[model samples]
Target: MIRVLEPPRLAAHRREPLLNVPPVITVLAAAMLLIQLVRDWVDVETGIEILALFAFIPARYDPSVLADGVLPGGVAADAWTFITYAFLHGGWAHVGLNLLWMLAFGTPVARRFGVLRFLSFFAFTAAAGAGLHLVTHEGELVPMIGASAAVSGFMAAALRFMFADGGRAWRPGVAEQAVHAPAPPLMDVMRDRRVIGFVVVWFVINLAFGLGEPAGLVDGSIAWQAHMGGFLAGLLAFPLFDPIRRRPGSDSYSRTSRF
Candidate 1:
């Protein structure tokens, strides 16, 4: 009997684990939802009270409020509001939009930065955004609430690494190809047409919303200043948190772990 050799079988293409996203993103979104539920179903007055305590309110630092002394149940300077306010939101739509943006952009940043760094990035960017809001509208009495600042930060960070080629940069194949393409320099990023275009569009949208909100053209309040602050913080500060990793092989970008 003659022995016959058989051809080796090719490995089946494993589906990319797109659904296996980072857990932190889900947790952050859940926290927002839980807070919103409490605000809606719990006591409306009590919820507002809680929001006043935790939400970022520049008036908290008013000279009169300071001279009157920080009252227990009244507005007072609370340093924690910077990070705490991000967990609170105005309404379902506000929270929903922020959560969606976070899930989209935060996942990649969290995957790249890990749990600890991601949390730190979120907190710092949020604080920075609040600071900007304070500087811009020091006399405003309204409380600034929502995760837009942190989400904006994540957006800017995503822009740094996500847009490898252009608007078509994030394609699965393109991601893999990025392993070979050197990460664009900070300056080069500004020069890239895609980046420039995205920045311009984002700036224009925020400006329109910011200006229109006061004119009563846009519904609800939009903390456009906070968004800009967060975006700038994430864009300028990403390098500090990012780990210095050598460019991976051409195929490495395709591997979900690179995310």
Candidate 2:
């Protein structure tokens, strides 16, 4: 009897879910959305009051303003507004744009940094943004609100490792590995042509926003300074937050290794 040879069946293809966002990202997004909803539900006066209480107003630190007690929340507001302002936004448009960028850049960061590190990084960047805003717009009464600065920071942090190890090309099913891959030293990253190009483009866009807003070419004033501060902080402080330790005499850092 002759037995016929048959081809082996192929394994079923596993599909990745469309929305593979980390839980921390989801929770942060929800919190911002909920805050915006409450702000919208309140009356105009209450909404303004909310901004006064939570938004980062440069004038809050002004000696005269502090003495007058014009702003609510007092000393507590002085302390909390650095991060609380990130949760507030001008409107749905502002918050929606922020959420979009946050998801795009924050996913990889959250995945790599884990929960606590990511949260601390977020607060650090937000505070840095607020600090810079105060410096640039000192004693200004305008309240700065939005998550753009922190989102910008996430974008900067992601850049540290996104292009490492031939990751410049996008390949399906390997995104997880790409983000978790070891990052090059900051000096090497600065020298990389790809990284340099992205930085130039990002700064150009911010410059355009800064110029256009004053010319009435843009609708709302963009807090580009705050964005710059957060981005710079993230780019420089990445090593501190990175769990991956670099092997001595090696160009790359690894998560499995010890310092």
Candidate 3:
């Protein structure tokens, strides 16, 4: 009896893990959560003291306020607050919201920039956000705290490469390749309709928050200006942080991984 040859068995497809977050992202998230936990555990006076030392209060820069010595940490707090404010949050809701966005946007950025560059970029954006906030609300007594600015920065930076190569849809096993793909020139990115739409929507939402807070339409005072500052900084300064090199005489970049 002649036996027919059997077709080769296909290998079983490996399932993708539910949470594919990078270690740096996890660390950053944990740090923010831990800080919030400490804030929650502390007494009212200590909590206020924590905000005084860590939160970014525009009035900290005012000569008059500095003279009064109302804020703690003196000269050093003024310097550190720009970066430290990013770690503080208004409440659990605030921290949770920031982490959700951070996880969404920070994942690809951490993957692309690696730990050091990503941290540097984060600090840069956070400080940039604080700087703009200082300018807009100079001498304002209210303290600004949250990671929204850095999260906004990551969202902006992600746009640079996420929409490249015809804007491939994010799918398991393909996200790594898409994120690693060559980032197109900024001008080309601006020209893309998808990018334009995203920018428009982002700005509009921020504008709404800015307008709504004054009108009592919004519950909390969102730092929309800081968000804009971070977004713009990320969009313009992305090249400075980007690890992938652009090919000469070409609009597209090379796939050489610097991380």
Candidate 4:
């Protein structure tokens, strides 16, 4: 197993907290939910749909707020819609869910890949997701929004972080090792296989959801294409985003004496 140098010292300075730091995903999700609850109160004074839906990713719905559109099926003429559309969402639940996923997995991936790179990849995936949606939907105001595309990319990166062979493991030292105990199976699933499982389930479930030719839950606006594209982006581009720090043969770094 990997060795811990000291009680306080860490291996490297990745510049951010760990993925589950402060359980950020949970906090963000909660905050979004709270904001949604307060929307009605704010609407009276603001007089605008504060958190209403806006199709912002593949194409920017003309109205900046929700409940205001009978949009065209094609792409937005302006290129910036690719960026703006990501901010819009169908509902509070959508925003909360997507952000929660991002925080849950996005933070750690950000740690490995630099923050800027993570943001870039995230945007690229969002755009790519939209492009995929456009290809599949073809000429209809599908009205898409949410950070699912970027989140998918993050999920892919996280899976690789977890499962790819030949990498560093923050192993415990003799003392910590002496007191150590293995975690339960469920925890192991959470620590390791969660990403892989998520990827598989996400792909299959979404694909199945889209099986009726956009007639099921997706309802003629399934962005399975975007999900796939974003996933592929995360799967393939992780190394480029965060070049793996090789230290001799990663295979041998762990202590082999332990049984």
Candidate 5:
């Protein structure tokens, strides 16, 4: 009799939780759903009132507009809209897409950054997104709501560390097998074909939305400018949020990395 070798096999039941979405993602998604439920049950007038209080209105930054229809929350509410608006969404589709993206892209980031750092990164990108929108659409009364800006930020940050130097995007459950390599240098990322292609595609899609009607996909007009702001913020500010640091005289790849 001759002995034969075989490849390793996984247990049939071990396929569950393959993607490993973080608990923080669950919390964020739940919050968005709950808020939407509340908004749906409320009367039309009250719904408008809620949007007024929570959504990011570019005109809110202008004192003249706030002088008339402002909520009773005072300046704090106006200042905090940058953070609150991200939690609200215009419709079910809007919230669903944002939640799905959060689970997919945000999982790796939260896993790498931990809860506190991940939240800080989220807050920073959200505010940066709102700031950019204010710059372009100043004094506009249209309310901007949704998580696309923050989600785009996550995508940008993921691009920095989630892909190998060879420009191959990492797949789910393969982070454990990844060769311990430092994130590509910023200049290298700019030159990478994959990165450039992704950026171009994202820009074209956004430009299309900016130029024409969204065909009822989202609840209202998409804020592509805010999305760009968040993407740029994450791409440029990832170094501040990244926790991995090389110790003196030690190889950076010595420790195992996980997404």
Candidate 6:
């Protein structure tokens, strides 16, 4: 089927600064959780306990493996938890804010990097976040969950895309970019300080929230660790997934991140 492009979804053209990928996913991710929250709230007694289910920790699935470490001591639960926790939410507000940030930054980065690249970055960063948590809360059963790792990856990708070479040049059509056309309304506001500032604030808030959440709440959420892991992973891995880039004169910018 020949898929028609949605004007707003395009990310290749330098029309403005549309957040094509990450932000949209962020919005969608949060929306799904929100719906679940409402449903659970309506029937509190039988809706599967919001706090535990929404959090994404593997132990929540069986509770019998709570005492085990992620790999050395427990079942293969850790393998799945590494990725599954990403979808789990904590509260309505928690998911809501995370989605907001994801949309705020993810879309633009996706626009620049394309879909597959974004997904790769998201997955790796998520794993990294879990890895960090595993190190700190290895034995206590923190039940770590959420998109903080992926979201932080977006931030890292954005930094690389925007700052690597004065932020003016961009690679178009690296992946099968469906939405590559220009959307002036969306693009125009992207470069504004307000948006950039918001991203910075997003990081700060995550750091603060990580400090206050209860122990064993989402694997003892060390939000900073997730954020840090994601950011670093994005920076290092962008070249692999960020479609090959070529300089204006050097024939092509190496898609590989040698710099």
Each model's RMSD to truth, in Å?
A: 11.9, 11.3, 11.1, 11.9, 9.6, 10.3
Query: If scored against the real structure, what TM-score would every candidate get?
Result: 0.81, 0.87, 0.87, 0.57, 0.86, 0.60
Tens digits of lDDT, candidate 4, 1-259: 0000032454232222432343434554465466546643464534133312324332233343323343332333335445445554445556666776787667666545544566677778777777776665554344555567777887776666443322222222221221122212222334555445666798887687545343322213445566777777777765565534334544322221211
Question: How would you encode candidate 6's per-residue C-alpha lDDT over 125-217 as one tens digit per residue?
Answer: 888876665565444434555677887787666654443322333344332232232212223334655546746786676667666654433
TM-score of 3: 0.87
Residue pair clashes in candidate 2: none
Q: Using lDDT as the measure, which candidate wins?
A: 3
Worst 10 residues of 3 by lDDT: 1-10
What residue runs in model 4 are displaced by over 4 Å at the alpha carbon? 1-77, 165-198, 210-222, 243-259
lDDT of 2 by residue, 21-80 (tens): 889999999999999899889998998888889988898899865565878988888999
Candidate-wise lDDT, in order: 0.72, 0.79, 0.80, 0.51, 0.74, 0.54
Q: Which stretches of candidate 2 lie over 4 Å from their true place?
A: 1-18, 65-68, 166-170, 214-219, 250-259
Cα error, candidate 1, residue 242 (Å): 0.5
In angstroms, how far off is 212's CA in candidate 3?
1.2
Candidate 6 achieves a global lDDT of: 0.54
- Please provide, for model 1 over 1-259, each residue's C-alpha lDDT reduced to its tens digit, 9 standing for 90 to 100: 0000012221121123246567888888889899988888878688767766787877677765444444234433367888888998767767887887888788777877777788999998998899899898785667788888899999898787778666454764344233233455578688778899989999998888776664322225788899999999999997777653445554232222222
Model 3 over residues 1-259: C-alpha lDDT tens digits? Answer: 0000012321121123235678888999999999989988999899888888998888888987666577889889879998999998877777887889898888888888988889999999998888888898888878888888889999999989887765663554556665676677899889988889999999998888666664322225888888988999999999899888867887566644554
Candidate 5 segments exceeding 4 Å error: 1-17, 177-181, 247-259
Better of 4 and 6 by lDDT: 6
Q: Model 6, which residues run further than 4 Å from truth?
A: 1-31, 38-76, 164-209, 212-222, 247-259
Q: What lDDT does model 1 reach? A: 0.72
Residue 185 displacement in candidate 3 (angstroms): 1.0
The Cα error of candidate 2 at residue 249, in Å, is 3.3
